[model samples]
Target: MIEISLTPIRRYWLASLVLLLLPVAGYAEDSVWKPVPLGDAASWPAWRGPLGDGVSQAKNLPTHWSSSENLAWKTSLNGWGDSTPAVVGDHIFLTLQNEANELRLLRLDANTGQIERNILVDTAETPREAPQRSSQKFHNLHNMASPSPVVSGDYVVVHFGNGLLATYTLEGEEVWRHNLQSEYGEYSIWWGHANSPVIFKGMVISVCMQDSLADLRQEPIESYVVAHDLKTGKVRWFTPRMPDGSAEELDAYTTPLLVQKDGQTQIVIMGGNALDAYDPYTGKQLWHLPNLVGGRTVTGPVLGDGNIFTTRGMRKPLLAVKLADFRGEVPAEAIEWTVEKTTPDTPSPVFANGMLFTVTDDGIANCYDAKTGQQHWRERLGGNFKASPVVADGKIYFLNLDGKCTVVAVKPKYEEIAVNEINDTTIASPAIANGKLFIRGKNALYCIGK
Candidate 1:
């Protein structure tokens, strides 16, 4: 090897160059496959919130807000989606179909109700295929743009019922896009698919729990859980999710919940007549409890007290299955409690404090003991609730399809705090972030808070 001796000035210049190169090398290493932070604790980074559970940790949140009082701002949007808004930092991300009938993602100024960026997410490369209008019978309340968007740090992921799943940066640059149906097969479900995308650690997770492939003439089709690299959108791993149900019962628009209990973390999905758990990092089927037998599950499960509260499809039973004790060989003894009456057929159950609160598709609201499943109270608030109830400041806020929000006390006893109203129609759930409520309606997006 030949060595060159340098002068003092030359040596100093070389040292500076080397120092700059070190950080570049380190950044390249850290940039690839790194865990994306979920962002501000007060931010609604996902469909439900930062915890992936439909509960927020915000305290002193507004208990009462009306159209004229405590009204922040109301901004008009192009089209509507049943999907909830995802808020990160100053931007609120929502998935919508523009007037041109193109699926899109909208970013709005969170402080003021103003459109910041409108990114067309569904392009020819990621085409949004509407099921034949003759058979594309979605529930009267939903459409193709129903799945909510989830955000984590610099990345925000949006999904549409038409199978377009795209990820973008907070600055509105496309990171990667994939059509779930294109890669798998055409989705043939009774109603359109509306399962939202979720994020865990270094990956963005998606679940397509639909009808059996044989039934759709796509013999190999199966429900699947997929995890992708947060930065590059590379498929980290794909796992086949086999839920046992028949025909119409096979379709599940339910989102998976990430539960960490008893020093063990697992992704819990409720669908196809069963509640199962999978290893989130590797997508391994860890342990599963079968025989739930509830079909077309819309209610996502919630966790509390070493047990998870789940609604078995629709109009069946609200069950609390003990998870901490059972591992393998799950049998009939796993389910600890069941409320078999007035369970919701559409809206999901929200677990907050020590109560499992649920509202039916019509108007009935029931509060049950989270552990025992004993009915605390059954009350009718009188509007049609499609949005899941949210809890904050010792009150539960339930928004109905008529744009009315009924605030209830968190006790076992039924107490109505306030019945606030908005004029627009909505099927989208309300999102809580930074001490404010973001509710997307058919005609507008309302930012309501004190």
Candidate 2:
């Protein structure tokens, strides 16, 4: 196991200088699209579990637990971040940054919740200000470690708000790293960047949907989707993503979602007033549904029952778009149903058992039929919510900011089962594996199991 302690000598100036000297371009790798293999059923390896949706196969998950009851282990993690754990096999990968501004990655033992490996990935400061824009500030609730670590192949890719994307082995050996802003341009987003990278076939995909600065100058800053070689960190392909929106409407903190359908896979992204898909192998735009026209988006899209469900930013209407063999532009008829009331703004929706569940940042929970879009029930779960809900066993877990998890049945009707409290601040979403629940709080990581 590796442990890296933060020292006074480590600084961001050295890291920035090293990244600025690396090459800016590289040749594309093979174009054959081989999907990322789902290694184990008991692992929650990515942002939204194994399927990139918040549904877990783990059974008999504990529905009720306090800070002392049904607790497997609680390990105190230094510093703070709002990233969900990437649990694979017996290791849990997480990212955080201390007051020293040192971005770090820790691999913990799953059974004992012990920190097995801790590596200082990079150093970056928070509230990275734009040139002359004071209104474009990062929120106080999150920092550079807000983007979660993604485990792909034998490497765990971690990203920081400073545009530092680095890959390290599971054993804490560095593979390669890149500072995106050094190669591209400085970010001009309203808030901080928090988009987690997604692993596709043989490559890692990342999205940057931010302020174009078109409102400020003649030529707008480019927002693009870029793919890099999983093993070498070389740029494989880059597709410019200039959507038809302006001002804050152009900003998106949402992550890229990989959707596999009928033996074909597409990278689905929701932001910049549009929902679109891209070819995984070639970095080409596949199809787009334009004119979504919502404010800066944070809520991501979810797939269920042969349809894509998403909400526009700022509590806009929820959309249920049907899948099609679309070419250039998706037509208006592709929309199956829509619900305008009680939609979520920050937390992404979760689907299970033909029912979809969503909780607004204000704590209102709404259940809908996954296919018909009919509202089955709407109830308040209480407390503010920033974490997305996760479903396991026969219940859906709605975690609030106050570290309270309200477990409800997966049926259409609202049936509350248990309300568990941990006496900590939890904003990151929960991860489930092997019949146990993993929750990352503000100061500690808690494992709840029977």
Predictions in order: lDDT: 0.77, 0.84
Residue-level lDDT of model 1, residues 304-383, one tens digit each, is 65577777886777887765423443555556767767889888888777888999999899888786777788888887
Question: Candidate 2 — which pairs collide?
Answer: none
The CA lDDT at 28 in model 2 is 29
Query: In candidate 2, how many Å is residue 341 off?
Result: 1.8
lDDT of candidate 2 over 1-450, digit per residue (tens): 111111132356345334333222331232222223444667888888888888888988988898678999999989999888999988999999999999999999999999999899999788745554322457888898888888866889999888999999999999999998889888878788889998877688999998887878888888999999989999999999999988888889888877764456788899999999998999999888899887899998888766788887878878887655466776555677778777788999998888889999999998888777777888989999999999988899999999999999988788999998988999999999877999999999999988
| TM-score for each candidate, following the candidate numbering | 0.87, 0.90
Q: Point out the worst 10-residue segment of candidate 2 by lDDT.
A: 1-10
Q: Model 1, residue 34: displacement in angstroms? A: 23
- List where candidate 2 sits over 4 angstroms from the true fold: 1-39, 128-136
TM-score of 1: 0.87
